[model samples]
Target: MEKLLEILNDIQPDADYETCTTLIDDEVLDSFAILSIVGELEEAFDIEITPVDIVPENFNSAQALWDMVQRLQEA
Candidate 1:
């Protein structure tokens, strides 16, 4: 979770990822930022984020991202 936060902070330092649940809805992360996040996440956690996983729900907040990472790691 800390690493996920670090990745998100590196990509967008302005947003409060810890409590920001409207990251996608509020446009806190643009398309490029999302892509960068996906790349960082995949490389950091050794998880493959498929197109199917690229949904607003999964990228909404730090907790959601952390949950997705854990799920993928178990797979």
Candidate 2:
């Protein structure tokens, strides 16, 4: 969770990771931002983010991102 928050903060410093859930819904993260985040996540966590994993539920918040990372790492 902390690592996820770190990654998100690096991309959008103004984002409140704790309070935010739907980053896209809140307008905190757009499509481009999600791409940047995917890049960072791949590098930082050593996991490949597939197109199938690019759903809004997976990238909605810090918790969701963390969950996705865990699932990918397990895969």
Candidate 3:
């Protein structure tokens, strides 16, 4: 989870999960940020993020993103 948190922190250092969740829920994440996160996750974890996996809930928080990465790697 530390790695996930680190990745998220690199993206938005001042953000907490609560803030990130709200940003996702409110459609405040621009396309560039979303793509940047996707790229970072793929490179960091060596996991493929398909279109089907690109859900707001999945990227809403560091924990949620970690769970998704674990699930994907497990699969």
Highest lDDT among the candidates is held by which one? 1
Clashes (backbone N, CA, C under 3 Å), per candidate, total 0, 0, 0
lDDT, candidate 3, 19-61, per-residue tens: 3656577655667777888899899999999999988888776
- Candidate 2 TM-score over all chains jointly: 0.92
Candidate 1 lDDT by residue in tens digits, 13-63: 999986789999999999999999999999999999999999999998899
Q: What is the lDDT of candidate 3?
A: 0.78
Mark the regions of model 1 whose C-alpha exceeds 4 Å error after superposition: none
Candidate 1 overall lDDT versus native:
0.95
Candidate structures ordered by lDDT, highest first: 1, 2, 3
Cα RMSD (Å) between model 1 and the true structure?
0.5
RMSD score of candidate 3 (Å): 1.9
Comparing 1 and 3 on TM-score, the stronger one: 1
List of clashing residue pairs for candidate 3: none
User: Which parts of model 3 are misplaced by more than 4 Å?
Assistant: 18-20
